[model samples]
Target: MKRSIATLFILFSITIVKAQEIDSLSFIKSKRMSDDDLAKKREGTFFTGIPDFSSDPVTGFGFGLRTNTYWNGNRDNPLFPYTPYLAKLKANAAYYTSNARELVLSLDVPYYKGTRWRFKIDFKAQQNPANLYFGLTESTLGQLRLPSDENTTFSTYREFDRARKTLRPGGVGEADFVTDALSNRFRETEYMLNLKADYALGNGKWRIMGGYEIQHLSYTTFEGMEAEAIDPITGQNTTAPNGISLLRRDFEDGLISGVDGGWVSIIQTALIFDTRDFEPDPTKGYYFEIANEYSSKYIGSQFDFNKLFIQGRAYQKLPIGKRTVLAGRFGAGNIFGNNAPFFEFQDQWSPEGSINALGGRQSLRGYRANRFLARSMWFTNVELRVRLAETQIGKQRFAFAVAPFFDAGTVRDRWQDLNFKNIKTSYGGGLRIAWNQSTILSFDYGHSKEDRLFYFGIGQAF
Candidate 1:
């Protein structure tokens, strides 16, 4: 898998170089065109298509297509300015062969009607036929009891070793035992609809935002697995009764029995202050936001929770070069009310919808999605982006960049228990490609104490 990923990256780099060369030759050939002709050709919608390649522990290497369309909503009104009121639509879909499938569609209408208001709507549907789970909370390792006794605390690697050492008298070894006993992989289907509106304040640097979200989530265990049981007398592993599965055992143990599948309706509001020069790839300025969310039976929600979130980001253009920039973000979230649903603990439900509490590609890139969950969490990310190249292909503009970043975060069962030493950290670098300053393609590689991960996605992590 590593070799394949390396080869794919090499091919991608070669393709980028070739495309630059081709653009250069095309520019030379177009020198005969008058400036007026070039200006006349630039007044239409621009479309960009890019091949997507992404991999993670959950979905392996997946290939797909991502398409973006950008146009000025005031295209017909020649007197109107071109930017700050632009419209964008994005559609992306990916399939991990036999592993998983995802589709996302979103539209953004900024500065509608020359007013301060902006609107955005997004719909996402995903089917993960086999998604991984490492139990829940701090009990995941203790529940396995593989590498040592129930009370022993050891690294994940050590746990695997212990599992091997204690293979049942006639049972499978550690690897196979973990794969069977802890298949942890299950099928999950999720559909989300998000709608948001923002109204700018006095200077257009601050804004008030409101949004509603409807989510439907369901899960089922993967098939074709033999259930395991422990022999009461010998402590050996053996096959369980017919119709039993690892997922069933978890349900019987009451791990995720609550809030497994349900409808979650959320109403959210936020106050935002943004001075960034560009939304997709900000060069300079500060962005800060505070948000509140309410979900309850009164609001047509199956579960109830009130969440408070706050986040801030800073982007500085370095004097080292025209293209060097430094960007950093800090954010935290806490859930209130009784019996918060496990699904709501996800990093996606907070202020701006872009900032995650922790884990996943958006926050801790080296960790798995929803790797950590608690009532409250905080995270920070810093990156230094350096532009490697910029050029024009036909009438479209393109820029390539490389960014090295650091991420650290931690989750706590209670807000007051937050501690810095518990923070999980990761360091990584990323490759970014921008088109027309509106659309971005990203490839990042991150390493953490537990694992190393590679992710390919759209837009900035923050």
Candidate 2:
């Protein structure tokens, strides 16, 4: 899986370079403008195109367009300082040459009313024609046993045969048992809307925040999984030979609750303490946030649950150079309810959706997305970031950085069941490019005992 993903990333890089050539003429035109025009473009609204190359286990190779509109709120309110009033609106659309498509639009207002308030809104719609799903648990590794012939029902016999074929050593079913296996092809459609407001308190060192979120999720079995298969005996209806059937049927049978999906509504509030000098790439300071979310029958949620989240991060500039810094983050989450939805149990969610707990590019870099999920989880990350170079192009400043990081985490069905000794660990290094002062592009590679993962995306991984 690592080798294939690396190769795909190389191909994606080459393709994006070619795609960026289409926008070179516009960039050159802007570079040739008068000094006053250039300064105006920098202070006012200016557009830039970024090469979009991303890959995941589910989305094989994705290439697309990301356009950013950057401007200063001070242009609209001269009383505000330009540094804190900088804002961005971004639109991203991409297609996985393999089997998926995604579109996202976001607005970030980091300094409303001169840093006294901050706001953000995001809208995303994605169609994953084929996505993978292992069972709902912390462990995907399982022992396989053949069924007994005596008094076995037909369903039981069929299940035994399916497992035998899928879980066999070095057989077609063997891939399912590997770290990359344990997957099914399903189509997912999701619509999410999030709104948050933060108010600064006591000389802007502390903040009070509130947010609301609504999400609609739908999933179905994708067709064409058996399109290439043929019956060996009768050459008709290649059903049993399809690998996806096993996993898809499990979902249909309610093996994991809420697989069909529905609506989820949540309201949350938090207290935050932040002293970071800069927001985009913090240099020296500490940030701590503790929050709670509630979903109830009165909130128009399909499930009733209460969730608690706490996260803290600290950054310190190294003595070696002003550009070198060490950062560490710790986070934990727990869900409480009679029967919470399995999807909500994922480690990606917090009071602030931007924070990640245990998986994906932002959290445990080596594991697959949502690879480990449970009722409760805790994770920590440490990284050393060194800025290597800085350059200016067409009134924009860019900084290149290298970061080496370590990550570890664990999850269990219940809080008491948590075993610190069973933690999963990964280590990796990454490259980053910061545009202007805020926007960031990152490429990272991570490795663990199970597999390796490569990620390319925007923003700092905190």
Candidate 3:
């Protein structure tokens, strides 16, 4: 949920049950539909309720159901040709095998009731038992070589340390403890509420956006390895081994705060200019936005911070071939104010909403989600999309395409320290399924120096 709605696993099932697009990233229109195409469009409410199932590396396997309803009204409506859907209501209840869970409800409306305004509201309760923390920024990458020597496993180190503690008792001569990859695991539970509104300028090409968001986040750090007395009767150690998690160590060292969690309330505004031919799967035109977010005590926020992000995306149809296009995006963001919470460093927000920065499917793709976190960051994505075929399925339009992409980014502890030096990169390709000109099912595999990741998502990454 830290990124666009496309990153949500529930979208996999929702897209399968029905086809529609209604979110921050999809609202503008740049092309006019022909009379014949408009005549074939469907009107009225489209409703569907079905069992939902999905599998992914982060959430494991999940099963649930969603109530998805769309109201498109008549083609005569002024917004019909411009908006993906006139209005939408979607609700979900689900559980994952990894002990993760979710309860969410969302609503979106564009050109509200013939007006020039757009509105969206979302509520969610999410639990991530496998949340990750890699110690922040480029430094975390070095930790992948933990234990130093190839022959030393984390388990052997822990056993040896336990023996040393048992022999030394409380003596100061004991060796300093060490942690490995498993130490990055933690638990996070969040309750979030978001409300957004957008007003169009005279030509409906420029927009002013405003929003409010609040989140209650709680975390559970790992329990460290402890020494225990041997059982007198059984003559065996009765305690289990546990190593201190990176999150716990950071809290103790004062590297991070708010372990118990608190309120993060923010007010956001942005100026956006868009001229995409299609919002869901843009084939031409450009989009730009500059967004600002402020969080302060006066806004009921327990943490204070000011963030600014500027981004641009462009799509061009390649003249070399039919149905071939080139798409590219570039973004840079920085957070000001010393009181910004650690979690805020992982995200970059715009009128299109937050995308996990520096890494992850929406950003670098090859790196793990939020593998790098810092106060300032920059990234770019470029992809070549070529349509392979198209067909009509019982009045529904379907098309398939293949996209080869490249991603790169870097992060810095401070905006003043930003540089291109140590940039991380990912290269990959994906298959895209366009359903009814709105929904897209995307499958991608990415590779980087540290990890290889596969992403199955609903819509274009931008």
Candidate 4:
């Protein structure tokens, strides 16, 4: 662990390159263009320079800086802790050129013209840790995205619960009802800082990309996350009364169990390869990517967790005598060493108790939230998309279209210790639009067999 952290630190301090020039993006001028016509125009470039670097879409490589601000909602509110406003920025440059050498080396993205190899130095800073993309512990993890509910297991719930308990308020033992809720707490403020780099091999048809990720996070949960009520140094439980507390409805049902102190460290190495010469295009927008990610804390496992993920994403444009497109992705995670939190229900008077639990956004969407859960959990997600309007309606900024999508995944508890076969699934879809190819508007309708959900956001599904 010490060696890994040292390597990352050395890599981060080693390079500073220039930014590459980026060409403009082009698209079909009409909603009526035939599929073949759209495919023929693939020669247009997003990279006008050797190594691509643009602050716009955040594509190429170079020495750049990025800042992300995530403003969640007020913590004193109710069930939901965040309102969701986010913006990310970066400054970077890169260069790439080919020589008649035995091995290829260029900082350019291998798929485009004049593009070679590309490398970048990136510094990310945020006063609020919750704004970070990933963290080691549950609380530090911030606005986490779990696998689909249909795929989650009881163990997943338990691991989640364990993490939540670290942040409970009201000192130690709170109300049964409130303790249960606090055990599944959410928080608002967090600050973070990160430094990393990206390296890509440009071969036109095949390319390999990988990099290092390091971050420091300070976060807070809606529920307090400390075990003792008083400060060990000052002799006081500094977080109480003002934070979320685990209170009882009557004292039989569990409310919250514990609160946590949100601080963690994460360091990872990533590697990915793209085949079939994938390029982003409106007409021939087809590509497939398969990647494996392994993450661990550079420091010891103070939070107790480790993760291994095998996932894949694919995109394709359909040609059924129409200029339509379809894109989707599927992913699953097998976690070990990490303790997910759940609930430990107490019966009327039986010392301690455990019945069963289920239901959350990660899976079982049709069921009420936290409806059922157990020991271990597994989850998966898949999305289907369509392109409605790609060409200009009248003015360049008037382009728009509609699409219906479907999403499904599940979670589980413990089924012979097999996470793959235990969870369930749900499906749904939505609509999208683009203005001058710069700004995109999206609305999606996601549903399970028994529940329907709507999501509003920006950009393409990819």
Candidate 5:
């Protein structure tokens, strides 16, 4: 039996309950930007689009190219009186085709010197669709972010964001200087390969998703694994649990840790779904997803984590008004394992970091980046979208949409901690300009008792 754990899927199952009802423009955006990018849209969240991988399935030939830029510099920081621009560029495109025998080729190119590029192909047979489905997803990934004399930060994970969240004034701003290379830079550049397969059981309307991916994680970053661990209990942190304090965690965004060395291995079976049985409208429907995926760092990678997750989404047309629609829902999940991986965020309200509001595009709309990364958490949202304008764009009609929504949720606590009797809530509205049958540009602002924020994104929050 594979030694892999079931943490990922386990949490997936529990959260399986939550859902999304993606509509028109936003629907397409969610698919393109993907769960990963949507999540990154949140402040303080890790820029996991690092490898720029697409979680959606692929079976045909198509090429896509995207370039992303990140410019961040504070005017108040004394590190360098002059605010400098921190720029990042990422672009990717892929093509794929298949033969009856299950053969495919995929080429991915990413130019940003801070990420990775990949090419993938697969071959297998659908011997028995009745009870077994076997296939392969093989991939080769190369480095895009190579180290340069001017570039020094090794790991750009949330850990760095939290550490840099606050600036302490000493005799000179030089106090926050990077004297050690490993602790300051993300410098590894390497290649990797991954293989995967899946099988599922049907339970009437619901078909559980379970599969595995074998991965080879061999890359370098400016930082090392021994850096520091964000205190889940007290946002305050120490570099070495017993020796030194590395960088302080930032509660506004979220916190993340860094790792070094490389390991490759097979992840255990997880879950997935084919919501066709639940809804028919490809643009607006009701369905859910759950997973308990698990994998090791590298083949011989040091620490391993097991994770569990579950989520659900649904939508329908309402008679409230013209071009008016109602869609949205709630989601909850948990993580458990010897060393389960988690999204970290220094909670300003809590100080210490425990898995709480892993804020992302999917969870909290007004927050900036991983406003609150959490290991154990709950996320919820309710939206009513309406299309006001109708015009043709190219081969498709364009639409202007407005959605009034209420979002309420919390993290780290069990259901009991959340009082259905009384909950923390936020209200907001947004506008969207849609093109063709596929794209959208949205601006949503939400306000709550804690904070009020604005969100400008490519697609829908569903």
Candidate 6:
């Protein structure tokens, strides 16, 4: 990709030429503290563990182990000036390279012991296996091109030329690998489990959330995906079953609904209104939410639905520098019953979080991650952020920032098919680190109209 974008623009111009030789001598208490007194003399427990080697265009190389623990309890309590730690923990366990696999655990205790509620918990388990199915509505965006003529079938133009190819398809002017080969027909296989919770409503900037989710799906189409054709009147070759897979032709034309595997079960709720002065990395405030979900069969859900979402976010500080900021987000969602289980219409919810929307890395960042599905959807994201340098090591406190982003969205299948038509955008840049001000480590890259991702996550991407 142009030598990985010229080696990430020469490592972002050597991090802006070593940001003043790494903040000169790493600022010795800058004339005696006051980054809020060096964050109140660095309160308490703080741990971080790394080694999570990454790469992603949806799960490529993502090795394992990631950890974070922060406590910050008493700077004379009282939620120590509005919280950013008073308890936080995260754990991750990756395993990508297409066979995808993940395990995560999280916890946050906002205003908790200091009153006005605020608590959270999250757990996840995933299994992927190439998961991805480009069909659900909006004509799956005209099947993402590449079938101009060929009356369709060479395993659907080599699986849409392995998702929009770029050479390497048997080389030279590609597209000629007949006999149904790489056809998982848009792939399929997923296993999931999610658990969530949140509570705080009485001036902890309103909150109330709940959750329990489940998923189990599988589909393969037909062993090695047959394809032979030419039997109009039995004069020769025969085999084709429409060469299978669009999740087995939407489960044999029923237009999807648990294709051969089951377990859906869900229940969730939300109503939030955070004022983000710092929910890890906010610079200013205003966050809003409204979520709802349910799946019955009397809650052991084998399918039956209800969903709703609404979101908003904002942050601002940009008066030109000294740590500029400007953030934005917007959302919308829908899915009212009548059998919800086409992977639950590509998720979207909030209580402060939930995603999988118009596309990847937290919504449209260079697409491809649940790349659009339907039943209703909407999205937006904007960014600015700036802060070039800061340092300190012993008590750990580092800072560096730069963001530049934009994203857009669209989707539908109902909810009267909304009508923002097509949409789908991306543009980006990012880099942030601020370890001991409460862990953040992003890295973004974006750029879409069909992909150009690069993300290393931790937070922000709100």
Which has the greatest lDDT?
3
For residue 368, what is the lDDT in candidate 2? 62
TM-score between candidate 6 and the true structure: 0.30
Candidate 2 lDDT by residue in tens digits, 172-229: 4322222112234456788888887766554456666777889898876532232333
TM values, all candidates: 0.77, 0.75, 0.80, 0.48, 0.48, 0.30
Off by over 4 Å in 4: 1-115, 119-183, 193-202, 218-263, 275-305, 338-384, 390-398, 412-422
Clash count per candidate: 1, 1, 1, 109, 83, 0
Candidate 3 lDDT at 398 equals 73
Residue-wise lDDT of candidate 1 within 1-462, one digit each (tens)? 312322343354344334432111221121122232223333457787887786665577888998988774433553122243267788999988646899999898876755556899999999986554544453331323332133544455334433433323322222233223334456779899999887655556666677788989897763334545455457676663222234455566675444367888887777778776566677677888877777778778887777777889998878876578899998887877656665566654544455544566889887766666667788899999999888887778778999999999887777887678567888999999877666777889988766678888778886
For model 5, what is the alpha-carbon lDDT of residue 131?
Answer: 12
Please, what are the lDDT tens digits per residue for candidate 5 over residues 1-462?
224345444455345434322121221112222232222122211121222122111122323333333332343322111111123333333322321111122222211121111122222221110110000000000111111111323232333345432222212222432222122222222233333332222222233333343332222332223444344357665442111112111111233232233442434434434332112112345556554444555534444554445556677667665546677766665544333322212211110001224333446654433333334455678888887877754433456788888876555433334335334456788787654323455667776544456665444666
Name the lDDT of candidate 2. Answer: 0.63
Report the CA-based lDDT of candidate 3 relative to the real structure. 0.71
Backbone collision tally, model 2? 1
Q: For residues 277-364, could you state the per-residue lDDT of candidate 3 as single tens digits?
A: 5677877778999787887788798987788898999999887655788999999998887657777777898766579886777899
User: What's the lDDT for residue 401 in model 5?
Assistant: 82
RMSD (Å) per prediction: 12.9, 13.4, 9.2, 17.1, 19.2, 20.9
Residue 42 in candidate 2, Cα distance off native in Å: 6.2
Candidate 3: stretches off by over 4 Å: 1-41, 48-55, 65-68, 141-181, 224-240, 320-322
Q: Write down the lDDT that model 6 would get.
A: 0.65
Native-vs-model 1 lDDT? Answer: 0.66
Better of 3 and 6 by lDDT: 3
Writing each residue's lDDT as its tens digit, candidate 6 over 1-462 gives 312322343354344334423212212111122254335446777788777876777667788888988887767754565666778788889887766778888887765665444566776666665656667776665445432232433223235544322211222223333222233334455555666655443334555555677766655544234444343344455443323344665666687776666676766656667776667787777788767766677757577777778888998887786778899998888877555667677667665566886677888888777767888888889999898988887767778898989988888787776767778778889888877766778888898756578888777778
TM-score of candidate 1 versus the correct structure, residues matched by position: 0.77
Model 6 weakest 10-residue run by lDDT: 22-31
**lDDT values of the candidates?**
0.66, 0.63, 0.71, 0.32, 0.37, 0.65
